[model samples]
Target: MQVIDLLHTATRELAEAGVDGGDLDGQLLLGACLNKSRTELFLAADMEVPEEARRVFLRYLERRKRREPIAYILGEREFWSLPFIVNPSVLIPRPETEFLVEQVLAACRPRRGLHDGWILDLCCGSGAIAVVLALELQRDIVAVDISCDALAVAQQNCRRHKVDDRVALVKADLLTAFAAERRFSLLVSNPPYVSRRQLRQGLDPEVAGYEPLLALDGGEDGLDIIARIKEMLPVIMRPGGEVFIEIGAEQGPALLRMFAPSAGAAELVKTVEILKDYAGRDRVLHLLLSGYGR
Candidate 1:
């Protein structure tokens, strides 16, 4: 069949299945099968698709129709302008996480002193944050995730970006694997913050059905992992270190209170500010420890 015909069929099927951006997904899936760019696919609209390629396109279409994310289907997703391998084992890196990376860079780039300390990436998943930071900061990073499968994918991504040597992938439950003496200058995380009620209420099939639950469930209030990280901050963070954590929009107030100085949640925490995403919603919690730059 012609490329255009297959694209139309895929688009219709995906749209009927309630997939958003069906046309774009169709283009991407067909392009992957043909190993062509979307532009090239359009240019070759009249060209005939090979039988094997056509079959693969149909199979990809079937997966999309079932609400599988295009990133998982394509076996890759672009984060911070670099392609990273992804699968059911890891959460697909979202654009909001880029904000987390941005805040981290902004905090550390201007200060040379912050460069000397250790960097930790909690719940590193596909290692997107670690790989990007390794490349951007040219520093060593220890990335931790609980799932070996997720760690394996993170490893592949690290190697793919040629940052494997700098980004150490560790399979551990949060900071449990770290020693008390292991203080870090900068710690960043995109941990599981989805509440149990949110899960029960439901997420898109692409998330609830395909993404790893280990990376999504944040406990009853969705602050379970964040709370744990908060508890460890006073112990693990350097005197002047900074932390950037991606969080739900509604979570800023709770986190503010959790990390507030008066709350004594984490005594050394000097400031707790929530950074907004593109939508101006609370997205990241930026914390500066006491004695910053000292």
Candidate 2:
């Protein structure tokens, strides 16, 4: 069968199995199997695929038919205009997290000593935010994650973006693993905030079965990690520091209340702002902090 006809047939089959962008997915799978670009695939539609190539592509199609994410199957995903290596060990970086990164970039601007100013990217899955900030802002950064496998992917991405020299990668849960002396002017994260109830809501197979549970399950109420970060804010941040976090859409007010305190080690000076994703859901939390109330 010709490649174009095969793609049409595959797309119909995939769509029946609930896959969107069926034709694109089919083309990508075939191209990967043949080590050809999509344009090449288009040009060679009439060329016969060898038996070996056909078999390899069939295997990938089988996985895609099961609703496995194409990114995981491809072992890479692009975030913030940069390609990142991804696997089940890490959560797929989402466009929503980009808003948090933007907030940090804006806040971190106009501040002196940026070269020496430290930025900590907590739960640095795929190191998307950390690498982008380091490369774009030329700031020193430390990216922390609990899973070593996830950190490995993050490291590769850092290298790909050529920010390895500016960013330090650490394996730790939140900020707990950092030395006490380590303090940052900016702290950012896209921690797991999906509640158990949300998970029970039956996620897509691409998300539920294949993606790592460690990167999705957010404990009973989904604020477990966020709370921990709040408690450690005092020790981990310098004076007049800022934090940018991505929360579940419904979590903005709750998080603001939890982190809000008047006479504490890390007083919430003001809620700088909350930003919504393209879907119009509140997804980012920005907090301005002053150390131990001056």
Candidate 3:
């Protein structure tokens, strides 16, 4: 059938199946099967697709119809404008997470003697943050995560970005395996902040059914892990060191209260600012420490 006919049919099918971006997904899948860019796909709209190519495109359409994420189908996702391989093993890096990286870079630029020190990326996922930070600053990084599969994907990303030498992967529950004496100049994390209620209430099928729950379920209140990390600040950060943490949009105020002098680690914190994403939602926390860790 003609390329346009095929796209038109698939788009309708996917849309009926309740997939968001169905038409765009159809275009992308059609372009992939035909080995053409979107522009080429449009130009070739009236051309006939070979039989075998159409079959492959049909399979991709079926996957999307089932709500499989496009990133997993494409086997990669772009973050910080660098492509990183992805799978069911890790959370697909989202645009909002980039705010965390930006804040880190912003905080790093003004701080003297910030270069060359070790950095930490907790709950590292696809190592998106770790890879970008290492490449952006040339600092050695120690990235920790609990899943072996996630670590494998992260390793591929580190190599893909040629930051493997500067990035170290560790299997750990938070910073549990880390030596108590080791301290870092910077720490960053995009931990699982989705409460069980949020998941039970419902999520996009692409996320609810396909994405790793280990990376999404943040506990009953979603603050379990975030709070644990807060208490451990003194163990990992050096005096004047900073941290960038990505949180659920509504969790920022509670996080600020948690880190305030009356309730949390006020003695160690020098400043705390919750930065907003493009949507104006609280997305990242930029915090600096006032003293060296034990």
Candidate 4:
């Protein structure tokens, strides 16, 4: 059959299976099977697809119909204008996390006396945010993760971005690796913030079943990891250092109250601020250390 006809059939099959981006997925698979770009497929719509290519295309379509994410199939995803290798070992980098990176970039930009600054990306899956910092600022990065396998993927990605030299991958349980003498100019993370109850209810099959559970489950209230990081804030961040974290939509006010203590505790102020995505949901938190006096 002509490639165009096959593409149409695949799209219909995918749509029937309830895939949200069925047509686009079908076209991408078709392009992959032919070892051609998606744009190339559009230009060659009328060309006859070889028999082998057609069979492979059908196989990929079958996998998609089962609801496997396209990123897993492709084994790579684009983030921060760069390509990153992704697998079941790591959580897929989402668009929402870009805002966290933006906040960190703003915080880490060069100042007159600040040189050789440091940034810590806690739970640095695939090293996306940390690597970006290294590439942009030419600064040192300590990318930490609990899972060695996930760190391996991050190592590969760091090498691919050519910023591996600037990053130090450490295996530790949240701020444990940092000595009292060490401190970061900026700390960023997109830690596992999904509650255990959410997982019990089932997440996307690709996420709940395939993605690392250690990277997703946030215990009872989804604040397990966040709380640990918060406790470490006073020790790890230098004066005037900041943290940018990605949180679930519903946890905004709770984060604010947690960070900003009053009366018995030091009065927390706007320095621990929240930012919303275009969806108007609180997705990123930018916590400044300026207001806290030593």
Candidate lDDT values, in order? 0.90, 0.82, 0.88, 0.82
Alpha-carbon TM-score of each model against the true structure: 0.97, 0.91, 0.96, 0.92
In candidate 4, position 291 carries an lDDT of 36
lDDT for each residue of candidate 4 in 1-294, tens digit (9 for 90 to 100): 888998899889988988777888988888878888888988999999999988888888888888877788878888999999999889988888887787667666655323434678999988988888888887888999998999999999999989888899999999998886536767789999998788888898767667888888888889889888877776766766667889999989888877766621252223777889888999987876653554
For residues 40-81, write the lDDT of model 2, one tens digit per residue: 999998988888878777788888999988888888887888
- Candidate of highest lDDT: 1
Cα RMSD, model 4: 2.2
Q: Order the numbered candidates by lDDT, best leading.
A: 1, 3, 4, 2
Alpha-carbon deviation at 264 in model 2, angstroms: 6.3
After superposition, candidate 2 runs with Cα above 4 Å error: 35-40, 113-116, 262-266
Residue 210 deviation, candidate 3, in Å?
Answer: 0.4
How far residue 33's Cα lies from its native spot in candidate 1, in Å, is 0.8
Q: Write the per-residue lDDT of candidate 3 for residues 137-191, one digit (tens) a residue.
A: 8789999999999999999999988999999999999988867663787889999
Q: For model 4, what is the alpha-carbon lDDT of residue 289?
A: 64
Provide the global lDDT of candidate 4 against the true structure.
Answer: 0.82
Ranking under TM-score, best-scoring first? 1, 3, 4, 2
Clashing pairs in 4: none
